[model samples]
Target chain A: MTGSKTTEYVTLVSNDGYEFKLLRSAACLAGTIKKALDPTSGFIETTQNRVDLPTINGVVLEKVCEYLYYNQKHAESRDVSDMDIPPELCLELLIAADYLDV
Target chain B: MSGRRPRGAGIRGPHSALTDFLAANNISAQEIRDSYQQRVRQAEQEAAQTDDNGEGPSNGGAEVEEDLQAESSTMAAERTRKRKRDQDEAIAKIKKGKAAKKVQKKKQKKNSSDDDSDFEDVMDMYKKAKPLPGQLENCELCNKRFTVTPYSKAGPEGGLLCTPCGKEMVKDTKAEAKANKPVVRRGRRKMESNRLDGMTDCGPKTLQQLCIEKLAQHSEDIDELGEMPEGIMNRISEIFSKKRAMNSTTMKLFLQPDMDRVAIHEAAYLETEDYDQIFAICPNVKRLSLRNCCQFKDSNIDYMNEKARALEEIQLLGANLVSNDKWAELFIARGKDLKAFKVEWLDAAFDDEAVEALTTFCPNLERLKLERCKQIGPDSIDAIARLQHLKHLTLRFHDPITREKLTHLIRSIGTNLETLCLEHFLDNTSDPTDDVLATIHTTCTRLSKFRFTENNECTDAGYVNLFSHWSNPPLRYIDINSTRDLDNTNPDGPQESPIGLASAGFLALMTHSGPSLEFLDISSCRHISHETFTLVFDGVKQYPHLVEINLSFCPVVDTHVVAGIFRSCPLVKKVVTFGCFRVEDVRVPQGIVLIGAPRAQDLIEQFGEGSLDL
Candidate 1:
C-alpha cells in the first residue's frame, strides 16, 4: 500500500479460528497459502498506507506452520537423510507437501 | 570462570554418542547416513583420530563444514519462523516501529543467501554417492561392507553372507568331504556247491569239504525242498499203484510234469522238436547266463517269445545264430518284453532295418553292446538316434562311422542321449577340420562320457572350441589316447603337417575343458608333455569344479607336476596315471585309485568296466 513495495507474508486461519503467521518465502511452499491469500472476502479494504491482510484461524493454521517449518529446516540442513521416518509418515508427508507444493 | 551455558540438558534428540556406538557395532556408512545419528559418528571418528595422532587444529576445517550443515537446517526454520512472528508483531507495531525496521529486509535477504549455499553443499554430496540407504548392512563375519549378494545354500544360522565369505563357507564343507574317503568293503562272491552236472546227492557237506569236492553251491536250504501235503502224496501213490496194476506204470512215469535244468537245456537243444517244452520248463527264470551257448539257434529264441510273459533276463555270448535278417523279426519280437538282452560278437549283416526294430521294440532296454559290428553304417546310427530311452549304448570298433556322420546322428538326438561310447572313429584316413570339431562339440554338449581314442586327426583348435562352450558342459568321463599328432618338432625326418601336432590341440583342451570336467583319461599319448599336464592341473585349481584326472603314458620330464595336480585340485576324487613313469612323486588322495605302469590290456579292462563314480 506504501509507495515503496513491501514483501508479502501469509496468515492462515484454522477451522477453529486460530491464526498462524508465516514468511511468504516459507508459506509459498503451501498451495493453501496462495488460495487464502487470493482475498475472497467482500470488503476488499484498500490500505492507503499499509495493506490490511486477512487474519487466519489457529488450529489447522498451526499444522500448516509446523509443516512449513520442518520442510524449510529439512531443506537447509539436508539432514533428512538420517531421518528413520516411518514409511507411512514419509508417504503422507510427501503427498501433503506436493498438495501444498512446499 | 563461572559456566554460562547448561551442560547435559542441551537437546533431547540423538547426538554424536549414538553414531559412535553404531560404528563400534560395524554398521556401514550407508546405514549411518540413514540412521538418526549421522553427524555424531563422523565428528567422533574425526575427534578420535586427531587425538590419537596428537594433531591439533588440522581437523578444524571438516568440523566447520559439519557444523555448518547442521546449523543451516535449524537456522532456515528459525529464520522463517522468526520472520512470520516479526510480521505478526509488525501488523501491530507498524505505527511504533516505522523508524526501527529500516534494515530488516536487507537482513532477511542475507539469511536466505546463507541457506542457499548450505542446501547446495548437501545436495552435491547426495549426488556424489547415489546411495540407496537402508538396503544393506555390514557383514559381521567378514568385517567388510557390501550390498546384498544372493546366497544359494542355506546358512547354518538364518541370514546370508557376502559372496566371498559364502565361497569360503562352501570350501569348508568341501574340506570336510575330502576328509572322509569311501573305503571298498566288497564281500566275496557267493560260491556254488550244487554242481550243474546232474549231481543230486543228499549229503550234508561242509563248505570246506564242498570246495575240495569241486561241488557247485546251493542258495536254498534242505527245508525249502518242494514238498506236498501227506494227504495229496497218499492220493498220488494210490493212483500210481492202480495204474501199475493195469500195466500203465510206465505211462504214469512218462507223464511226469517236472523238468530239471538239464532237461531245459536238452529241450533248448532240439529247436524244432521241444520248442514249447523249453519255454514251459523255465518260464520265469531270473538270472540266465548263456556262456558260449553256441547251440542256441534262431528257433531257440522262440522260448523268449512264449515265456515273454515272465522271462526277466537273457544273455547270449558268442551266439553265432543271429547272423542276418532271417531272425531279425524274431529278435525284435523278443526285445519287446525282455528287460535286458546282451548279445556279444554281434558282427553280422544286421543292417539298418534290424537295428531300427531292435531300438523301437526295446525302449526299456538298459545296457546294449554291439562290439566289432562293422556292418552297422550311418543308417544304423540314424535308427539308434531315435531310441531316446536308451541309458547305455556301446558301439565300439564300428569302422564305417566317420566323425561327420557321428555328429549328425548326435545332433538329431539332442540331450536325451546321456552316455556315448564312440571309439576308434579317428582311425579313418579323412582329414579332421575345425568344422568337424565344432560340430562334435556343439552337438555332444549333453554327452557325459566321451571316449575318442586312436583318432589322430582331432586338432588343438577342435579341443579349444569344444571346451570354450562349457558353461553347462556335461562331460564327466573322457578318454584321449595316442594323441601324438600334436608334437610338431618331430625327430624323425620332417613332419608331414607339422600342423598336425597334438600339443596345441591338447593345450587348447587343457585351458578350457578341465574346469567343468569331472573325469579325464589321457594314456599312451607319448607326445603329451609336461606343459599340457601343468596347464590342465592349473586350470583345475582356478575353476574348482574338476574332480578326476588321468594322465597315463604321458612322457613328461618331472614327476612333481603330477604331485602338484593332487595339491592344487583338492576336490579331485581320482587320479589314474597308469603308464606314466613320473607319477612316482604324486601323493594320491585317500580314495583316489592310482594305477601306475598298468598294461594296455588292464587299461582296456578298467575303461570297459566304465567310469568310477566319485
Candidate 2:
C-alpha cells in the first residue's frame, strides 16, 4: 500500500494520542500510514482498515513523523543537493527508524 | 559370490541374520537399511532375554544397543560379589588388634579430657617405632606395594621401593623424557626451507625485483630510524624516475610502512602546496582502497581531478568523502566515463537531497550499493528508479519502502532490474501486509534474482501472496531464508521436515511452477520440509526445466523421498541434501545429473571423506 496522500499540512494521531502535522511525502515514509489510505472511502484511517498496519503510539509516532517531515523539507529547500545535515542528527534518525521500523 | 550360508555355523543372535545375509551374497540396495534395522531389532531381543533373567541393568533398553556388553555385565556382577567377600575377610584381621587396643583405652578414660590424653599417649608409643625390614610399605618412587629394605631407603626423602620395580619405572620414563626434548629446531629448519622454496618459485627476477625484495627485508631497519633516510628517499625517487623514463612500470618499490606510523608524512602531504605534486606522482592510478586514512579528506579530491577523465572505477568503500560534498559530486560528475563506483560514508544520515545529488551525478551508473545509509527512504528509491539503465541495486538495512513507493519505483525501471538485494529492509510503521507483496508481484516483471535475506516485516501470508503469482518463471534465484514469520508446518503436524525454506514462502513457489528455474539454495531456513517438497515436486513433470535445487543445512529427506524427487524432476541437475540424515544412496533421473542425493556430489562433499568425489 502506498502512503496516504497528505495535504501541505496534515494531522496524525499516534497510538498514545499524540498528534503530529507533516508533509504528505514525509508521512508516506511510514509504511503504516501508507496502508491507512482507503481509496474508496477517501478518509485515511490507520487502524480498522488495515489489520496488518503496525500500530504506532502517539509519543513515538509524533517524533518519527516529525523527522520525516523535517527531512523532506530539508531536501526541498536546500538548493544544493550535496548539503549534509548534522552527523549527530543522522545517527538519531537511524536509531529512531530502527525502533519504529520505518 | 555364492548365496549359501556355511554349514554348521552357529549364529550369535537375531543380528546374525543380517550378518549371514551380508556374508551370503551382495545385498540389494532396498534391503541394506532394513537389514541394519533388523540388526538393531536383534540387539533389542538379546537385551530382553538378558533382562528376563535379571542379568542386565534394570533398564531393558539400556542394553538394547549393546548385546555383547549385556552378557559382560552378568560376569562383572559375579566378580564384584567375589571381590566384596575378599575385602570383608581382609578387614576382619586388620580390625581385630585395633579393637582390643580401643577397648583398653575406653576403660581407662572416664572424662572428656581423658580421651585427648589417651590419644596423645598412643601417638607417643609410635614416635620411635621403626618398621621391620621385610614389612610392606608404599614405594616412594612409584607408590606401589613393596618390602622395606636398604634399597627402599634412598636418603631422607624415603625412596621405598622394590629394586626391580624402581628399575622398570626408570626404563618406562627414559624414552618419554627423550621424546619430550624439543624437536622445534627441526620444525624451524623446515619452515625456513619452505620460505626459500616459495621465494625461488617466482623464477628469474630482474634487478628491480631484487631491489624490492631487499627493501622488504630491511623494512624494520628503515622503521627504526623513525623516518626514511633522506638519502634513501632520494635514491627511491631516482629509481622511480628512471623506471618511468624506460616505460618500466613493472618495478614496484616495496617498503612496508605502517599506516599509523606514516601519519606525519600524510599531514605534511595534506598541506595545500603539494596537491599538484601529489596528482603528478599518481597520475595513472584509478582504484584506491583505503584503511583508516584519516588524513585523506575531500580536499584530496583536487589531487585526483586531473585523472578523472580516464578514471572508470573509484572504490572508496570506507572513507571521509562527505567532508566536502561539492568536490565529491564534482569528482563523480567529472568522471562521465565511470563504470563502477563503491563509496561508504561514515556518516549515517542520508535523505532525498544527498541521494538526489548522487542519482543526478551518476546517471549512467549501472550498479549502486548503499550499506547502512540511514537518511534515504522511499524518495531516494524513486531517484534510483529514475535511472532507466540501472541493472543491479543493493540496498541493505535501510528503512522499508512503502508499497506505493515500491510500486512507483518498480514501474519506473523494474523491467530492466535483474537483481535486487534488500536485506533487513524494515518500516516500523506497519508490519508486512499484502499490499507490499502485490506491489512486487504486479511490478518488477523481469526480476530474475530477488534476495530479501532478512526482513522483520514479512509474514507467511505475505510470502505466499508474492510467490503464488509465479508468472515470471524465469526468476532463478530467490533467497527468503531466515524469515521467522512463515508457517512451514506440514499437514501432518511437523512430522517430516526439509530445509528451512519449507515454510509458507516455499509452498508459495510451488503455486507457480518455475519452468526455467535453477540454483535454488535454501540453506539454514529450517521451516523447509518434505510436505513442501512433495507440494513442489508432485507437479514437477509439467515443469521439466527445473535444475539445481539446494536444500543443504535443512533436516528433511529420507532415502526414499530423496530418490523419488531425483527420479521425478526430469531436468534436475544437482540436488544438495547435505543435512538430510536418512539419505545414504545417490539416485537420479535417468539422464539428468543428481548432485544432492545421498551419494551425489553435494552430499558426498558434506559426508564422504569430506571430499566431492564419491
Candidate 3:
C-alpha cells in the first residue's frame, strides 16, 4: 500500500451485514456494480469505493461475488460449465442476478 | 481450518441460510417423515375400530362375558348399550364432516364461475379509473415522460399517450380510414334509396316493390338528364335496358363522334338505320363490340365496310343476320389493318369460307377469339393457324378438332404467341394430346400467359417436360385448371392417382419459373400432396413477385402448406382456398387477403379488412 496509489479492491455490503471484498475488474462484470462503483459518477458509493445492495441477501451476494470472479477468470474462454450451484439457492440466485442485470 | 471446505465442494451441502434456519426450527426431512407415519398409524387404528364395530355383538360376546364375571350382569348390559350409542354418534359426525367438505367444494366452483363473469367488469373499471393529474407516464408514441391528466387520450397502439401525440395519431388514423372507405356505385345507391322508401312505409320491401320504386324514379329522371361520365352513362344504358325504357333518345346519346372504341350490348332496340347512323357518327372507332345485334342485317356490314374503314378490331356476338359473303367482303376490305377479331355464339354467317378469307387477308392480326362456332371445322383452324404474326389466340371450339390438327396449329404460329387460351367445349370428344403440349413447349418460347382448361389428354409427363427448362423468360401468369386425366380406368384405385401436373411437375415448374410468376391458378389439380407442397416451398426463396394464388379445389392443401406459402412468398396478396376442407382455423397475416375458410373470415372480420397490395 503506497500512500498516493489508488486501491483496486471494491467492498460490497449485503442487506444482512455480510461484506465481500473483490477486485474492481472482477466486480465490474456485473452491470449494476459497475455503474454504482463508476469513478466519474458523483454517487457516495463511487467516492467510498463501496456498494450497498439493500435488496440482495448475504447468501446470494456471496454467490454473486463468486460468479463475478469466476466470470472474469474465464471471460476469454468459451466454457463456463465449471461453475456449480446448489438447487436450493437457485431461485434466490436468479432473482439476485436479475436485480444486478448480469 | 477443519471447518473450511474446498471451493464448490459445498454445492449440495447446507449452503443457504434458509436451509440453516429450517434445520434450526426442527423442520427437517426426518420430522416430516415422522409426521406422515403418525398420520398413517392413526388412520389404521380408526379402520380397525370400524372393523370391530362391523363384527357387532358376535365378536364382542367373549369380552362382554369376561366383563360380566367382574360386575353384575345388568350393569354390564347397560355399559354395552352406552358403548354402542357412542359408536353411532362418531359415525354420524364423520358423515357430517364429509357433507360439509362437498358443500365447500361446490361453493368454490360457483365462486370461480362468478369470477369469470366479473373479470371483464373489473377490467372495465380499471380502464375507466384515471390516474391523478400530477402522475407522470411515458408517451407511447414519443417515449418521453410527460405529466398525465384525466383527459389524456390513449394512443393508437393502446397505451397512455401525451395530448399532442395522441391528437396527431387520431388525425392520421381518421385520414387513413377515410381513404380506405370504398366508393359506392350508382346501382347500390338506387337499391338503398328504394329500401329507404320501403322503410318509410313501415313494411318489408319485396323484390317487386323495390323494382317498381326504381322504375318510377327512373321514368321521372329520364326527361331531365344531362351529360354524365362515361361510367354513369353506361350504367344508365344498362338500367334502361333492364327497365324496358330504351328508345330513340336514349340510343342517340351512345353515338359520340371521335369515339375510338364502342361496346353496345343493348343494340336490340336499334334498327338498321340506327346502326348506319352510329357508323356515320363514329367512323374513327378502331374497336367495335356489338352484342344482341338481331336487327343488324347483311347490308349493315357492307355499309360498315365502307364507312368505318379504320376498324382494326371487331367483336360480334349473336350477329347471325350478317351473311358470310358480307363478312368476307368486310375482311377483304379492312383486314390489312385488322389486329383483333372475336366472333362468339354465331350459328350462321361465320363458316369455313369466312375463316379462310380472314386467314388469307388478315396478315397483321394479333388476337383472334372464336367461341361456339358450330360450322367451323379442322380445315378452318388449319387455315387460321397460317397467320404467323398472331400473338394472342383463344379457341373454344364446339366441333372437336382432331389432335393432329391442334398440334399442327400450335406448331405453326407458336413462335410469337404470348397468350394462348384453348378450351374445348364439354361436348367435344377429341382432346388435345401430349404432342400438342410438346409442340407448344418447343415452339412457343416467347409465351408468358398460358391457360389450358378442359383438356383431358395432357398428362404430368408433358407438364414436367415442358417446364423442366424453358427458353423464354419466366412466365408471369399461368392457369392450367381442370386438365386432369378424366379416364378413370381403375375405378377402385386411389383418387389421387397421378394426373396432369402432379407433385413432381408442379415442383419442377415452381423451382424453374416461380420467381417471376405473379398470378397462378392451379385449382382442381387434385394430385398434388401436402408433403410435396411443403418440400417445394419450405425454404425456397425466389418467389418475390407472386401476388395471387388459387388452390381452390386442391384437397391436400392443409393449413401447414398454406402457412408455408405465406412464409415463403412475402409479397403474396390474395389466397383462394375454397374447397380445401383441411385448412381450418387459419390466422391470416396482416395485409394479405384470404377469400375462403370460415374461421379465417372470422379472424379477418375481428381484425378489420386486410390491405391488398395489387
Instruction: For candidate 2, write residues A1-102 as lDDT tens digits.
Output: 366543454566655556666665566665545545434546536322322213555544545655565455554231112222333233233333443335
The C-alpha stretches of model 3 lying farther than 4 A from their native spots are A1-102, B1-254, B265-273, B292-294, B425-433, B487-497, B536-542, B598-614
lDDT of each: 0.49, 0.51, 0.70
2 versus 3: better TM-score goes to: 3
Candidate 3 residue B290 C-alpha distance from true site, Å: 2.4
Clashes of each: 25, 19, 0
Q: Candidate 1: which stretches are off by over 4 Å?
A: A1-102, B1-295, B310-317, B325-327, B335-342, B348-353, B359-368, B385-392, B427-429, B434-436, B486-516, B538-548, B571-574, B583-593, B597-614
| Candidate 1 per-residue lDDT over residues B156-252, each given as its tens digit | 5534455677788899999888688574342212111111111122222221222212211111111221233333323333332332221112112
Q: Is the docking of candidate 1 incorrect, acceptable, medium or high quality?
A: incorrect
- 1 versus 2: better TM-score goes to: 1
For B1-614, candidate 2 gives per-residue lDDT tens digits of 12234446765434467765754444433344444566678777867787787885455555555564555455445555665556554654455445555654664564345657767666646553333455555666667666666554442354455667666666768889969877534353443343333321212222223333343333333322223333443344343333332111211121222211111111211333333333454455443333233345555665566443455555543344445464346546554455455544435334567667767776776766766666666777788788777787777635666656665776777667777776766565654555655667766677787877665455555566677854555577776655543444542223232212346677667445365566566655656567766666553344455565666656666556555556455566556566666676553333333333434434332211111211
Q: Return the TM-score for each candidate structure.
A: 0.41, 0.39, 0.51
